[model samples]
Target: MSATSKKILVVNRKSPYGGLRSREAIDTLLVASAYGLQVSALYLDDGVFQLIQSQQADQINSKNIARMISAFEMYDLKEVYVDASSMGKRGIQQQDFVIPVEILTTEQIKTLLHQQDQILSF
Candidate 1:
């Protein structure tokens, strides 16, 4: 990696409306993309819920977070990953997500953590 290139890994470990962490994670990714950094988003634990299809935030009168996730590709962020076990636990399959995401095992996540230039969890 060049000095001007950044390998930023963002881990989203919470629900979108459960707290601010989910939104923050997406926001951070957007900012990183704007700066021309190589950004990767990892959905672990409850974070897998964020990618569930047909999320209706209008029931709670909140903004739709799923749409934000879908915009990642437009921003040139191609490295979206989700924990396989987490998705299974939440009854979410790969088909449940709008974006094509890499399903990762715990070992893979550990390896990615070591490979990243910066790791941010939210």
Candidate 2:
């Protein structure tokens, strides 16, 4: 992108089910990317659950977030990330996720946020 383009970061901190925040976060990322914005997504706490492979949203009568997440690459929405502490606390590994993500420590996430011109949390 150009130097004038703002770097946007979308932080997902909610569960995919029982709410719409997680899905909204993904939608935001896709929309931003479609507009040619520099976009990245960071999943923390329960939000990391969205990346779990083979989600069964049918049980909750909700749209499968995995399907939306799977379209990330097609939209050029790269730079997906997860917090290391959260992963350890929840006993989740990279293999447990639907797609490869760059794992970050709390400090690294802070640095990432600092580098962004905008941050949207859901």
Clashing pairs in 1: none
> Compared to the true structure, candidate 2 yields what TM-score?
0.94
Per residue, candidate 1 scores C-alpha lDDT tens digits across 14-98 of 9889978888899999988977888899999999989887899999998889998899988998999999899888888899897
Tell me how candidate 2 scores on lDDT. 0.90
lDDT scores of the candidates, listed in order: 0.89, 0.90
Q: Residue 54: error of model 1 in Å?
A: 1.1
TM-score of each: 0.95, 0.94
For candidate 1, report its TM-score.
0.95
